[model samples]
Target: MAAKRGGAPANKIISDNRKARFNFAIEDTLEVGIELKGTEVKALRSGKANIGESYAAEHKGEIWIYNVYIPEYLQGNRNNHEPRRPRKLLLHKREIGKLALAVQKDGKTIVPLKLYFNDKGFAKLEIALAKGKKLHDKRETEKQRDWNREKSRLMKNLG
Candidate 1:
């Protein structure tokens, strides 16, 4: 077998929704392409996008992301894109059907997890089908995280 010349290309992450995991119980995740304008793409290249409060939804038989803030490119002049426009997501018909069904029947939300540029330099959004966490569930998650951190600290000291 021939040896590969290089490893896989690393994705350049533009934004991450860290609180999404704490607030939602993620069931499934999908990588979907994003439709971007020229200025929007340039803005993202500067790594100033925010997906923390953004979410995806089925609109007119297609998936669209809302509330995502991609700041204007400083050098874009008069051609800058809107900062919080609803952007279309690119997915197959089958995938769109599945997501629509999950939202309508399963009471699940499509939450944006991360926004990044793939190895091929295409913009992508990682979205999750998730159910909102209850107050008790959130508390339990926090407690478990704290316990794991303490356990790791103790083990490090002991070893």
Candidate 2:
């Protein structure tokens, strides 16, 4: 059954990293821009990108997104870029420096949250600074989530 709340249908999300939510505790999140070629941009507009296997790394003090696959455009003539190319993320110098420091000192990693288009029709990425969870932590989180789901279901039925 489709779940709706507040007299509105749920948001239609294109894709999500279900594993990320199950495996990590996200500490902070930031929205960043991706530098892409024309062909890549067109492919993204068609909702043809996946960041599930992607990670962000600091190189020479700049943040670059790696392993995010954007499939080739079928109608491209000859300018298609590689599928797994590393793309530079646009951020302020201070933000880059802070990310580098947090990564190096705290051992936290940046994981891609989701890739989606904003209301302005531009492709944007939501990235998160996450601390990896241990095995027991994941189990506990799963238990809590299941309990919450049951509680909500009971409340709806009773009310």
Candidate 3:
């Protein structure tokens, strides 16, 4: 999703976890705000972060993102944030409860898809409820992707 600001769409992407789509089947998604420290936000603004190996979980009734690597800000000397800290995710109580219960009952895992700044300049995260893809399913996805690429090339040649 995107928001408009000053008559322009404001969705400046910071980091994207492309690996998530290849490894899991995303069933549901939500756009959530992220809570970040000063240094963490500075580091992210510089685009020096990775969320490819990150996942979210509930702890003590709150949701947190784990394993996301936002490197220390170069200008924030002596007061930099941890690079691999488990950051808190800002979500509503009802949504948090539902996501927690979904994980418990349906075994779906919460994965971060993309990180971006919204129109109001607030950091946001796109999270998805996904199930792991089996080996065969992964292989099939690869095969289908390859076929589509080849088909597009052939069509272009014919045209």
Model 1, span 23-77: residue lDDT tens:
9999999999999999999899889899998989999999999999999999988
Clashes of 3: 0
Candidate 1's displacement at residue 159, Å, is 3.5
Which scores higher on lDDT, 2 or 3? 3
Per-residue CA lDDT of candidate 3, range 1-159, in tens?
Answer: 675346435888989999999999999999998889998887888877889999999999999999999998988988788899899999999999999999999999999999988878788999999999999999999999999999999999999
lDDT of 2 by residue, 50-155 (tens): 8888899999978999999998987898778898999999899998988899899999998988877665555678888999999999999989999999999999
Off by over 4 Å in 3: 1-9, 157-159
Q: What's the lDDT of the predicted structure labeled candidate 1?
A: 0.94
What lDDT score goes with residue 119 in model 1? 80
Q: What is the C-alpha lDDT of each candidate?
A: 0.94, 0.83, 0.92
- Greater lDDT among 1 and 2 belongs to 1
Q: Flag clash pairs in model 3.
A: none
Clashing pairs in model 2? none
Displacement of residue 115 (Cα, Å) in model 1 is 0.6
